[model samples]
Target: MDEQHERADGPFRARGGPPWRRGGPPPWAPGPSWWDHRADGGRLPWRSTVLVTVIVLAGSTMAAHGRAGDRVGLDVFAYLLLVLASVQLLWRQRYPVVIVYGTALCATVYLAAGYPYGPVFLPVALGCFAAIVAGHRYAAWGAVALLWAAHTVVGHWLYGYLPPPGDGPAAWAQEAVVAAWVLAVVAVSELVRVKREQWAQARVERERAARRRADEERLRIARELHDVLAHSISVINVQAGVGLALLDSDPEQARTALTTIKAAGREALGEVRQVLDTLRAPGEAPRAPAPGLDRLPELVEQAAGAGLTVGIGTGGKRVTPAPGADLAAFRIVQEALTNVVRHSESRRAHVQLDYRQGGLTVTVDDDGPASHAEAGGSGNGLAGMRERAAALGGTIEAGPRPDGGFRVVAELPLAPPAPLSEDSR
Candidate 1:
């Protein structure tokens, strides 16, 4: 059977067994005959049904004509054998080997009874073809060998024994013809089986590739959302704490902190909404370009507003990286600064950007109190930063500094972006 059909059919059951064992309708049920449909849907197997029907009709007509001169009793028995053999062809695809065996047995009986040869051989030949096409190559060939032996032995018994050696070429030619026909059927069936398997394998690979793409897209969206929310929320958290502390003694400073918190919240909401909108409708134009090195000063200002004095320093000639690498670099710095504001109990932090020959390096260090030794030790923030760096073929290191406070360093390669395919355009 085709692999697709086999999967659809649920599982194999012993031939002629109870249908209920396989959760199928009884074999003799009158309504919507189980034999008329395949497992792929409830749709009728019209093509197979028509093919089997035509073969049976043609074979029966030829058999009746061949046996017209035989004894009435013998003719009736031959017709019975022909019917038995032909009826099973309908189920050849579902129980190919079984049908082959049954048809071979009926042919053997017909030959033994001395019925005249005509279409009596058709069913057995078709059964062999069906079995091989359904992936029972060995079984189909074995049945052919069995039928050949049965015919030879039965012919010798009914008629005079063959003359020794080179009496004539007629018998040899006949045997050769039968063998060639069976071999031809097997060869054709094998070719079709190989092609079917190749097609099925290709289909499976396509599905796997599609699933992998979906997983990567999901991860990209998650990373973007994490960067936006973590940084913005961290800034808001710090500003809110500062506002609460200064409310009584310094009303002006408290108002400034409140303004910073509101700004941070709005910015976070806008970026998050942009990410979500892109996810919801990918066909739309992108809301805005992603944050990159150009935004570092804004990030430093945000951190400063959150009560952390931040200093920025740069080295080497500045060069813009590819879009993906740029976004990764920006997120790494943002996440690091967010960690500084949230975890470090220090008043001062430093961000250093170094543009080198092949890549860019970002280092964030904070002079926080030693009591907060576990600051930025390990969490989703650091993990997200590491993931972003790694995706761009880069690396990140985060730990406490030997002097004081915590430090996070990321190195991002500045590779060119892959060109878009024509289909993408």
Candidate 2:
């Protein structure tokens, strides 16, 4: 990745799109809150547990009053059972199995004691829901099933032996109601579990997509900065050297070299500003059109200032390509010439533009005596060129020529030629 991207601005801001361009929850959309993260893990749910306990205690007391004659009244033992069941809910996130069993057992004992039934079942329902949602399905199901079975045996057969002295077997309709309630709890828990899993999966996908977008944007900015600075600086360097060499011996020539340096610097500043404007105000229209093949003449002029002669040639039919291919072709040629100016002792480079029925081909060649000693290039120009080409379903080949020079050839796909129709022919 070229390091031209501004880290502080971030990828979303650099893309010149709206605040919610991609991978972000839109402003109108509701996002997960701090409470939402508490679904499974994090801090213990202290406030919720205390609230449940309070409600259960008050409800159980009210039931004792409503059923004063039918069953045992709310005594200290009955109150303790309700508290135990509701309080165990605190650890449902971390120890759901234990809470499920504890609550289920507490509710069974209270019912077995012949106490009035009311909010006494609320804690058991909550425990089962938590356990199931926490993925302890078997434990939750078995705990509820065993509790219901124990209640059935006790209410029907063991009641005479254990509770309210002479209460007989529970009605079959009562067993049916209990079974229905258990089914409802499991169904609700399963629904919530599915929703939570989907939410988590979507969140993962969104984050992954956001990271990919950020990296691509960074690379693009880096490539642009590299090309702009490398080409312009190469020209400035050459001009500055000429200016110093002729400072006293040839005052007029030295002054011309300084002027060329200034021109190159100004042009570089303008292009750099254009590249950075996207990062600074991503939502605005560009200050200038992107450079394309039409700028090849300007590149030739710039290379001349760098003391490198460039010969441009064209073959095949000339046709306009898509905007992207035009830009890649231009940049590929620019970077190839910049590399030659910086690393080759040759004073002349050749650029060939071949437009074919299939696509556009750009080639840059420079004779070289391998000046690696003075080649201060960071080596990313060719990589950036290849990246630009590949992004447009194109290919790039760059290497030293077998006999003498370094060559860069790029094949960038244009829009498919429109189908021929009957015309003047």
Candidate 3:
């Protein structure tokens, strides 16, 4: 029977994994494209290399022409420019500031030397994209702005001609067009960065909330187990003692003690069965009237029956919490009173239950100084009570009272459950 009971309620038998992911592997098993480090950072190094190779070949092809072969000097310069720009791609992410600056510098030099701008500028655009994706938005935009300003300044002063084609109005239009393109890239990159940060923060908050709910659920299970087991165990201990003491002098009384033992065990078995029935399908209707604020009188009577002098008092109106909130309040009071019975040195303790418009407050105070220390050091009773209160967005404070005893005060909100109607159950 004990083995059967163990099998019935063992923690290891609890269901594992979320309902959605219970059957299969997640989608990104092979990993996503953004995290791909292969293909040389998707950099197209061979494009630059081939571009330079074409420039070299073009210069060689034009060697037979007249002063056009002198124009081949420009092709050679473009080839060298491509080589330098391709090298910048390798260190783009690791040293984005250096790479952006270097690319801009080399492009300026190649342009000034009369090198062809088309082949050399391809790597510059790639470098700009790389800088933004590397997680440096502000710096990337700053470098772009600085580069544009330098081009405008240098073009009007150092170079003999304006930066692009046409006179005053057309030239200004071209500059505006280029500036808008640069700003568009910066805006897109910044949007992506902001979205990534928001997503990460939201995920963290969700995980934290899930963990809090899991902890509350675990504490609720523990309270139920304790309420069932502790009473049964205490009764068993009392009866076993009576049986041992009456063994020789009163054999009939010893038999009566054994009968009481059987009755206690049977009661324990019934409660355990009820708990299991409740656990098996939580979606099923509740089997018993939930213990709540109304049950405090009954709880005190039970503690008194267990041989502790428990007192009850009230300072305010009566409280009727929502089903879950009431259950939490009940658990906190139950654990506190149980500790007074099991751990106090003195026989006397007072339980104060206060109900206000704001919330329900329960406080347990014992006249026994060092009751907890004398019985045993710290244990899970107080911790469980605090956890129960916190589960309901409430608070619990337990410590030595001013009157030289232990005190436990718990305040629980009177909020109702969302889906359940107040009149229904």
Candidate 4:
């Protein structure tokens, strides 16, 4: 009755039953049900149908022979009960508990009516086995207990059949054998139920792990695209404004600004294509090497061309960092310089890089008032810079300077790259 059990049994629906029939399968099948071909290994229900039929026939024949001395022949009513019980097994997968309870009731009636005891109990045992395999644990055990109680009460009143009959030691030994058989069925069913639950839990864990991996990959791609577009587009925007301002008064200056815009547009296009290639074919190597701290001189030259005076400073011996840390450090400086060009009124900017034993520190300062652009414009630039630093276990700070300008500082740990193995080289 649990939701999980219902989902597990979803593949086992009966076909061609009456319109009024709701839960259980129809009494007889005109042909094979759709689920018969899909169950377990396929054709499972068909095989079970054949096996149960054979068992009923062979059991009835043996029972008729065993009671020949008592003149108790196999009667029409006895044959009819055996046929009904065996035929019901074809729907065991769809309605396991229903089949078991239905068959048990029939067997109890036959016994209480003083019919010859034989393989009439075979269908009842088979139904319980089917219920267990379908993950109906409580229902199977409950049916077992109820059937045993019925057998004891009915047999005692009609034929003096108790667990330990009143006849003597011989009768007590027979009852002990029947009790052991019943216990074995219940034990086997419990072992199967435990195994089914373990397999289902393992499948769920695998799906969750796959979803987590996909989410992380998407975030990485988004960060790369943001860095490439923000830095490049900001430069183009500044150059375009300068070209428009000097178009009539200073033709020569306007020509230089237009030239800078052309170069920035070309560079931005190539970088955008590279980022898209990585998304399209992730297994291939990147077309161009990633920019890093070594490219800062070129960056400063570009800013000077855009009419901003920039100065660079360094301290201590230079040390190389792992690829991830190098990329993060480069993006932090690029974003800061982009902000200075687009948002600040200052024309002069100073950048300092300090290399320490523990890590590397970068600071960028510009002499400008804190405009509304710094306070409230879309925060993507600042947010992207912070994300890059945090990914490499670093930190970044950006705010107004006490003297009168804006300042940005970042610290990044220098993680050494792993040495290549002989086989890899």
Question: Which structure among the candidates has the greatest lDDT?
Answer: 2
| Comparing 1 and 4 on lDDT, the stronger one | 1
* RMSD of candidate 2 to true structure, Å: 7.9
lDDT by residue for model 4 over 1-425, one digit each (tens)?
00111111111235433322455432222212324443333334767777877888787779768876442466787777777888888877767778888788877767655555677777877788777767666677778777776666655453544222342222545556656766788787667666665665565454445444555455555666666666666676777778899999998988998898888778778877887888798699998987788888877877777677889999888888777778888778877887787778888899898999868898999999644553322457777778777767788999999899999999888894354553463
Per-model TM against the reference: 0.77, 0.80, 0.57, 0.72
Write model 1 residue lDDT over 30-110, tens digit each, in one string.
Answer: 122223345224444457656655665566566656656551234566667877887777677666778788888998887
Off by over 4 Å in 4: 1-44, 55-79, 106-136, 154-158, 161-191, 356-358, 373-378, 416-425
* Model 1, backbone clash pairs (residues 3+ apart or across chains), number: 1
Clashing pairs in 2: 16-282
lDDT of 2 by residue, 1-425 (tens): 24554333244465765445665544334222313443444778889999999999888888888987778777899889999999889878767888889999999999999998888888998989887776677888999998889888987788888767767788989999998998998889889877877786776556555665677788887888899999998899889989999999999999999998998899889999999999899789888999989999999999998888999999999999888788889889999999888889999999999999979999899988667657566888888998998788789999999999899999988873343332411
Local lDDT at 355 for model 1? 94
| C-alpha lDDT values of all predictions | 0.72, 0.83, 0.63, 0.70
- Clash pairs (backbone) in predicted model 3: none
Sliding window of 10 residues with minimal summed lDDT for model 1: 1-10
**What's the ranking of the predictions by lDDT, best on top?**
2, 1, 4, 3
In model 2, what is the error at residue 410, expressed in angstroms? 0.9
Candidate 2 has what TM-score?
Answer: 0.80
Candidate 3 TM-score, true structure as reference:
0.57
